[model samples]
Target chain A: MVPSEAKKYLSKEQFIHQAFSYLEKGVEPTVKTLWLNDEIQEKITEILEHSYPKLRLRYWQHDDQTVWFLDEIGKERPISFGISVKSQRINLVKVLEFRESRGGEIHMQAFTEQFDQIKLTDDNKLNKHIDGITGATMSVSAMKKIARVALMLDKEVR
Target chain B: MKFKLALVSAALLACGTVNAAEPTNQELLDLIKSQQKEIENLKKSVEEADEKAEASVEAAEKTMSNAADSKLSFGGYGELHYNNIEDKESIDFHRFVTFMGYEFNEDIRFFSELEVEHSLSGDGKPGEVELEQAYVEIDVTDATSIKSGLFLVPVGILNETHEPPTFYGVERNPVEKNIIPSTWWEAGAGVTTELAAGITADFAIHSGLEVPNDGGVYDFNIRSGRQKVAKANADSFAYTARIKYTAIPGLELAASIQHQTDLTQGVLNADANLYTAHAIYNVDGFGIRALYAGWDVDSEQAELAGQDKQDGFFVEPSYRFNDEFGVFARYSEWDNVAGNSIDTEMEQTNVGFNYWPHQNVVFKFDLERRDGAQDGDGFNLGVGYQF
Candidate 1:
């Protein structure tokens, strides 16, 4: 079930609007939103724990979408965020875009592929992993970490 | 004349002087028509002459452009490496590479590579100058093209991917070179293409001729004293193909196969075949790679009976501390199948750091440990650029 307080957050249109507004504010937002219930959230949290041992996620609910942001405690500039959802049988994870210097555009395709393989269960982490592209390794890796954070966010926000 | 006419008019006034003026309306009209005809002829002649002059100027410009193009372009890439080895020879090698490309037209281009290896050797006793690659390429489209000439065999990572900065080490891994051959270029022709959704592939036919010169020998045909004085056949051919997939972000997998017939162009031809599978994965600051390659050679002059096969494997792990600096390590091992050589097995470890102050250039230092049967067991450091 969706949370009662989730309605206070932005809808899809409002979310897109706010995202652009935040970008214009000079704040690089790493955002992730997904749909999930409590039990799947717990399983996803376990998956993310292995993926991102150093990160903890904070999130909020807004009608149908679960909005999550990666909170960087000590860093400035070049922050990334992502979101994952687990409902019944399907699990989805996505990195909600970030800015990279120059060749960042080349990294997008590989990042998309990495997110598609986000599995919220440790029963097959190695089997589901992929080798990075020759030049886009860093961006792809950063996105993977953000996806993990998003999966963790699902557990807490739910 | 006018006074006489007036006198006669007054006497004949007398007569019909007034009726004489109306005699010929037709004659006055004909006089005006003749002047118009002369003006029209002049205008037509002027227009035709102007057109001829314009055509001549256009022809001259085209001729000049063709003369200037002559189908030529200049490009090259080089690397300098520095390294510290564990207990033996350390390596310091610098390479200066230059190539001249000539476009025969939209369909054909000729290319050649001239490299100064270990330039520090200086003057007479210094490093050698080698002709690394020479070939002609035909572009069918932006997505597909064919190249024939001397080229790197498409067997392993180092053969086709030998851009200095593309790999981790100051030099290529030992397994890659001993098993797959480094700086390997031969006469061949092949097709390379990119399909819809970003699938890339290359297929080529290469000359299986190997020059018997040392790695540092520049002009194989010109050099006098060298081991294995056999020249590469002008007509030997080999076949190669590589297929790659990028279905996932930050990940790519590729496989390559190559076959060369005999060491020379002759019947009962000796032949060599190589196969490889390689993959790379990236997650943020970290990268991981694994590759395997195998080679098989068939020759009646058995260098080693049943020892005509060689194979190897390698793995590399790397991390970028930040954008400008990174560290990487690699491990590899190879077994030589040529039974005639004293060196049969080789293993090596390489650790290196790279600094890229700019995108197109890099400075690198590599230290390696080799417990192998080759004089190449030393370390290498290099700096290379691409533009």
Candidate 2:
């Protein structure tokens, strides 16, 4: 993994294009798209137990690191996760934002740290363990599913 | 002051003593020594400054992180029901519940559930206000946790997770409600350990139940023995243990056993033991559920009264057409007095449908047929929500 990779999208808001800055100060990140065809959509449905919200997903890449800003429902509200993949493994995972009334414990560093350096296996399963919180089972499950999605997407980009 | 003067005088003598622009060895030594001392002081000062900066950064990070992680979250669910049975009809606000949770840090948390049953509580009223669950859970490690306070016993599928929309039927299933006793809790301390894969085990010791003897109260009913962790007699205690496997996606299997030293609280030398097991499997919107629970009361009077051995089992097969609609049929049979031949067993069949306008809100309707001890036909309609 390259520790000193040039980061064009410095903050999470900038990475997800949620922040507005001086137009001359920053160039728009070069975005790429992955369309959810029947085959890929089926695989994603198997991973998430639900369909993707849109037909295509937009992501950003810098050197060997790629970023995915994804959303999944936790109980009744959607939770957004910012996942970074480097060299086909998880480089970082963070809760960019949360809308659920409960299950905020999933954003704790002790819990999110478990995803670092993890990758998908031959059968497309996580190679590491993700522990579930006492009252945040659904939220934890959502995070795991998003992690797998990011890894799979990384493989496609590669 | 002498050192500074000697250094200045050495410099002046060195300039006059340098006939060929070269200073004496002693002058050079004094100059280098003084310069070296000045460099050491700068290095020391920089080191201290760096330490202070790092400490300040650490404090800022800790504050921001804790503000994000230590949260107080609230959620709740409520249900209203209408049931008509054998020409008798009743419409009631069944339950109003509130849940509160506070995360003290990454390792400690507090949770509580408060409920109002039948929607009212007062003198000569048929409702009650109860604290069904309250506990503080401390993480001993990433894989293990210990909790203490009043908590629902980890015995059956619904006892620990019984939001109205999460389950089928208007009322709780009879087997869990009558035999294992749904919504049962006690003040106790327990440890939960998660092992490899998705396996978990729990063990706890808590207050026991006290069933009045025949002369004072009915002995055949096990559901009436609940003390609800109120200010009551605690001459003896109960121990419970459970283990579950959930490694396989969309599947869960679990079993629990509880032993009570005495259920009569020294009233009849009576004690009762309970055993329960359940399985749930779901795939592609199709699901099935099965459970069995039994009780063994060790008292001569309990046996003579034909209520020593009480047990039941139920199976339900359900299919979800989509996220918003589902249907199911269940068969349940239970007997509170099975110690001897008494023909008191009750068998029932229920068919139900649940409609979810939103994931957290649901509308439910079901029809039931009761045979064996009681013969009747009834149907229930309800609406429930959780947020």
Q: Judging by DockQ against the true structure, name the best candidate.
A: 1
Residues B81-134, candidate 2, lDDT per residue (tens digit)?
999888789999899999877766556777788999998899999899999988
lDDT of candidate 1 over A32-135, digit per residue (tens): 43434454445555543322222223344433334454411101113244343443111333334332211132234444544553544544232244444554
The segments of candidate 1 whose C-alpha lies over 4 angstroms from its true place after superposition are A1-158, B1-74, B83-92, B100-111, B120-126, B210-231, B264-268, B303-306, B338-343, B372-381
TM-score of chain A of each: 0.44, 0.81
Clashes of each: 29, 0
Cα error, residue B119 of model 2, in Å, equals 0.7
In candidate 2, position B29 carries an lDDT of 100
Could you give the CAPRI-style class of model 2? Answer: incorrect
> What TM-scores do the predictions have?
0.53, 0.67
List-wise, what DockQ does each model earn?
0.11, 0.04
